[model samples]
Target: MRKRVAVIGGGIAGLAAAVRLRDLTPPDTEIIVYEQSGALGGKLRTGELGGVTVERGAESFLMTGADGAESAAVALVKRLGLGDAIRHPARVPAALAFGGRLAPMPGGTLVGVPGDLAQLGDVAHADAERDHDAGRPLLAEGEDVAVGALVRERYGDEVVDRLVDPMLGGVYAGRADGLSLQVTMPQLARTARVEHTLRDAVRAAQRAGRRVPGKPIFGAVEGGMSRLVGAAAAASSARISLGLPVREIARTAHGWRLLLGPVPAPQTDDVDAVVLAVPASPAARLLSGVAPAAAAALGALDYASVALVGLALPPGTPLPDLSGFLVPPSEGTLVKAATFVTTKWSLPGDGPVIVRASLGRAGEQERLQFDDAVLLERAMSDLGALLGGELPPPVASWVQRWGGGLPQYAPGHLDRLAAARAALPPGLALAGAAFDGIGIPVCIASGERAAEDVSKAWEG
Candidate 1:
């Protein structure tokens, strides 16, 4: 009998799993991908605004090193022969909306944690005595802390609210105070536990020659992140079914069976192994009966909502040449961050300058409830303030809402995942942003790991 593997979900994680299964499994082994929606990429949406391709979901992936070659995302792109399509952002540093002025981001910082307080010009500093003193540890051994709390404790509220919040907003769309240091920023977390000061810790680490030098920190596909999804789907020989929602998963005589389609007319597929690569909520519901403990843990996970509003400014509109700016929550503005798409990426057509604003967060869903027009107005208002003047109306605009899109990585997330895995059935695996990470590369890695686990179980 031919072995069969069913991958539930068509997002990056699921696609990565299916691709790996096709590559690793025998010729007779069958691989199938089931996507609930018409589209394959979950949050990797790309579309045209003013005849130019622009990203609505995730836009880029962080390189593993300065070299940009070792990341799983890059490797996947190369494997799919998309190496030429890779694009790097212009060498421009982002600015922070500080005190109603655009301020350059201080050098020597790790995700908003300042390695040299001297670089931060009056953005709040730690007590000189405590900062220089030894024996004072930011974290005790084995102690997990929130990223926000740790940064605030060491540098003060100004640093966390200004530097960290904007960076966190760009990625998680959730508050830093609610995210785990160990899970969200593991390297910093490890360093924080032993070091007395962030500056000293950064210096010591750099001196130890642990950091990769002269590597591109981030990269994206030429068209958009959606290109990566398209390439992944086309590369694999796996059977794909779109708009087929998996309603149930049950253990069968030989393996697992998935109930698909609407309730009135359901279809079923029996496979030797299964991978649950959807978000936490749906994955929890799927595992409720089979893995009760895992379901409980997954159900406890929370998510954040956000809206990306794209605006096409009239040509020759006066604007800063920088990439973008991050608005700290302390600014009490509707806009969280802005990405100057035209400045960062290569657009296809000679369209108006493109800029996108991200609004809302885990607890700030009310702003997302506003109508598209209202959201556009609010984003423009913030942009005008940051740009130092009022601007003309947009020639083109696009609004994309992602409700419950980003999963919150609260403290102790790792422990919760461990518990969930302990309760999963044999020949079954879970992979998605809600697990270990929420980025493109991390999700790909998660899917690959799940495929490896299932393959090993089948072989053993």
Candidate 2:
């Protein structure tokens, strides 16, 4: 029989790994993809409201480095004929909500840390200005520091409370302190790795001149991220079994065995190799018996629950003058950030504007419980203050919830990740946001690499 491989989880990591395995292995190699959920693409889902599209999960992908991994994402998108569906070539006027106003992120700021310190002090508060001049690096440059603490130290409390914390909170749907800087802002760590100052690293990136995707910006895909997920599913040759949750993974003499089926209807699939690509906590639960060490390491990582409140406004609705708003850690508001989706993307026609307000990160998950109607009311009320108008209620509304979606890459994350991968057995591999990166590109890379590692060992 041909070598058989089993991939658990249907998110980008598992899906990408399965497709790439088909690409690299012998034509008859057998691969099976199991997704507990009925659909694929994990968190990369999009919503439609009265002809408008809203991204409830990932908002955009930061393009960087033409590394083999990055190239794979581009190739996948291109293969799916999604080149035109990409909405942006780079980052746009992503602003910080400070003192109740939108402030354009400082020019040349990399991951909220200034690469050029000459103008950094100019935009900062009086106290933080002193810290930056003294080169205190208010944020920890190498080790993991609470994102809020680092921003406060470098730019003063105002920047952290108003801009940095809220902005990150929205993206991660978790508290800044609870989230690790290494996983979320590893780019800044490069400065610490090569030199002591992030300012120096920015200079280095500038000298290197556009390391990723032939562009040095961030972007969103067109027609929504959902289409990308569907396309990948369509291209796969693997036997995909959806809604089939695996209860346990066990080691077998010939290969490995999966104890699957919801209680009262259990079945099994024994394959030559296995890939655990679910969220960290759940992955840990499934792997406790086969690889105790891998399970322990995965379970150690923190995850956050998050919710998105999407609103569909009528055509010609006037928006508050603010371009977009972020919630700093100090805001004491349930809302972490709000996106002006219409301004951020191109509309097909003059239709209703789509807006997304993010709520609940970690400790704030309870706030997501105000009930849907009440939740929308609260979101809009808070939005009104920032938008400054009695806009009509949304023509449509969608509420989506993700439990333990984004992984909190606390400080020393890379070290821990290396430790986890090192502990896995030779024929076994790990993938998904639980490892190196959480974005679609990062997860896809993890999947491809895992397949390569396993394939190399199997062939030998």
Candidate 3:
């Protein structure tokens, strides 16, 4: 019998799932991808600013995973024949905007948690005495805690607010107080399970994650992130159904049926297996009847909205030699992070100095409700303040807003997701940023895992 798989949500995760299904199943297996939006690559959109290719969504991904192996994203790029297009950032240090001045980010820190307490120079004060052994491990087996709560308990408020929060905000658009250690810093969390002190745990985690010397930590496609999305989609060879919403999914004796399109006139798709790769809310809605527990867990997840402001300053505009800087929420600025795109990447024939600023943090939705012009103004203002000089008006500018774009992985997020996955029925699996941790590599691995799960169910 010819097998068929339906992949809901045509983002990177869904497309990656489709590609994996194609690789695993027989050549005759049919894979179809349905995307609610008119486009693919949910948070990997790329745009042109002043004739320069720039990413409107995620700009880059970690080059290697914690084990010092090539990241899943790099592996996918190789599989898709885009290995040559990989571009590493220039070896410029990042800074933290503190008290209206840029301070070099401290060294030997795991996501802003100083592995060596003595290395935390000027960025933030750590209470070294409080980091002494408590005669027990920092975390109990299978227990989860917020990254901020754990750090604050040992290092004090300065460490969490000044160092950790901004670093986390740059990636998750979430505060450290709310994000889960297991979900965000799994390596550190694992070490904390056995290590008696927070500093010791950080040291152990850092030692475990020691990468190859002189290798760049981050990478991006030469063209843009869109190239990655396009390659993955083409390689998947799945029937593309754009701008259609999958209304409901119901299990059938033979397999599964999906109710898609509008309620007035719907379409049905029957498949041997299905991959739910959408965001938490919609995934919850579709799974409510079939997997109530999973639905409830999915519904409990929260998201953060953010806007990216890209500017193309005239060539010869003086900017810092650094790649970028992150701003602590205590700085009271609309801009949380900014990247010097052209300075960071070796773009060919760059006509203008490209800069991208990220605005808005978790639980600050109202601050991002402004129009593009207003948001751009606020971002430019913040940049000027950070740079300590008024920047010249850009020759070209762009603003991209992503509402609920980032998932806030609360404490126990991984446990909740595990239980949700366990409760799901056979022939159905979930993938994407919501189920797994965020980031391109994580999402890609998640999609591939879902593909494997459904393939096994079909084989059975």
Candidate 4:
């Protein structure tokens, strides 16, 4: 019998799952990817401005994992024949904006949790005395806590507000007080399980993942992220169905049945296995009847909305020498982070200087309701203020808004996901940023793992 697998959602995660299924399953196995949106790359969109390429979504990904091994994303790039296209950012430090000035971001910090307290010079004050050993490990086995709660207790509010929050915000569009330590900073969380002090835990986590000197931590495709996405999609060889939402899924005697397309004119697909790679809400709805517990748990997860503004300044624009800066929420500004795209990346042409500003944090959806022009103006204003002078009008500008894009992994997220996975029936698997930690590498690994799980079930 010829086997068939359906991957719901055409984002990078789903696409990665399709590729893995093609690799692991028999040559005759049919792999189909159904995406609700017309586009394939979810948050990896690449755009153009002032005749230069720019990333409208995610710009780069970590090149290596915690074990100093090639990250899943980098591996996927190589597997898809994109290894040569990988471009590392220029060696320039980033800064943190606070107290009406910019200061170099502290080094030796695990997502802004200082490994050595003395490194926090003027960025923020760390309460050294509070880090005294607490007689036992900071966390018991199978326990989790918010990153902010743990850091604030040991360091102080200043460190959490100035350093940790901005760093996390740039990644998750979420505050440290809400993100789970186990999900966001797993290395530190692991060390906290056996380490008696927070500082010691940070140091231990840093030591475990020490990188070779001069090695670049992040990498991007030479052209744009879309190249990576397009390459992965082509390599998958999956039958692509775009703009079709999978309405529901139910177990069948032979395999699984999927309800897709519009309500009045619905479509059905029968496959040997199914991978749900959509966001939390839609995934929850699909699993409501089949895996109610999993649906409930997935439904409980919230998301953060954000917008990215790109500006292309004329040539010879005198910007700061740094890559960019992060704005803490305490700054009470609309812009949370800005990236100097031209300065950071080694683009080929002498194009205009490019700057990208990220705005809106978790629980700030109302702030993003403005029109594109309004949002762009606000971003420009914020950028000018941070630079201590008004910026020249850009030769080109672009705005991209993502509604409820980032998943907020609350404490106990991993435990709830485990229970949900346990409750799922055979032949059904979940993958994507909603289920695992965010980031290109993590999502790729999640999708591959899901593909493997479904393959095992099919074999059994």
Q: Itemize residue pairs with steric clashes in candidate 1.
A: 66-215, 67-215
Residue 10 of candidate 3: its Cα lDDT? 88
Q: What stretches of model 3 exceed 4 Å from their correct place?
A: 348-350
Error of 2 at 459 (Å): 0.8
TM-score of each: 0.95, 0.89, 0.99, 0.99
Model 3 deviation from native, Cα RMSD in Å? 1.0
List candidate 4 segments past 4 Å from native.
Answer: none
Q: lDDT tens string, model 1, 300-333?
A: 8899999999988886665677788887888888
Candidate 1 residue-wise lDDT at 69: 45
> What digit string (tens of lDDT, one per residue) describes model 4 on residues 1-460?
8999999998889989999999999999999999998999999999998999899998899999878899999999999999999999999889999876778899989999998989899888988999989799999999999999999999999999999999999999999999999999999999999999999999899888888898889999888999988998899899999998999998899888999899999999999999999899999999998999999989999999999999998877878888999999999999999999888885543689999999999999999999999999999899998899888999999889999999999999999999889999988999999998899999999999999999999899
**What lDDT is obtained when candidate 1 is compared to the true structure?**
0.84
TM-score of 1: 0.95
Consecutive 10-residue window with the lowest summed lDDT within model 2: 126-135
CA lDDT of every candidate = 0.84, 0.71, 0.93, 0.93
Q: How good is model 4 by TM-score? A: 0.99
For model 1, the stretches where C-alpha displacement exceeds 4 angstroms are 65-69, 132-137, 202-213, 346-350
The true-versus-predicted C-alpha distance at residue 226 of model 3, in Å, is: 1.1
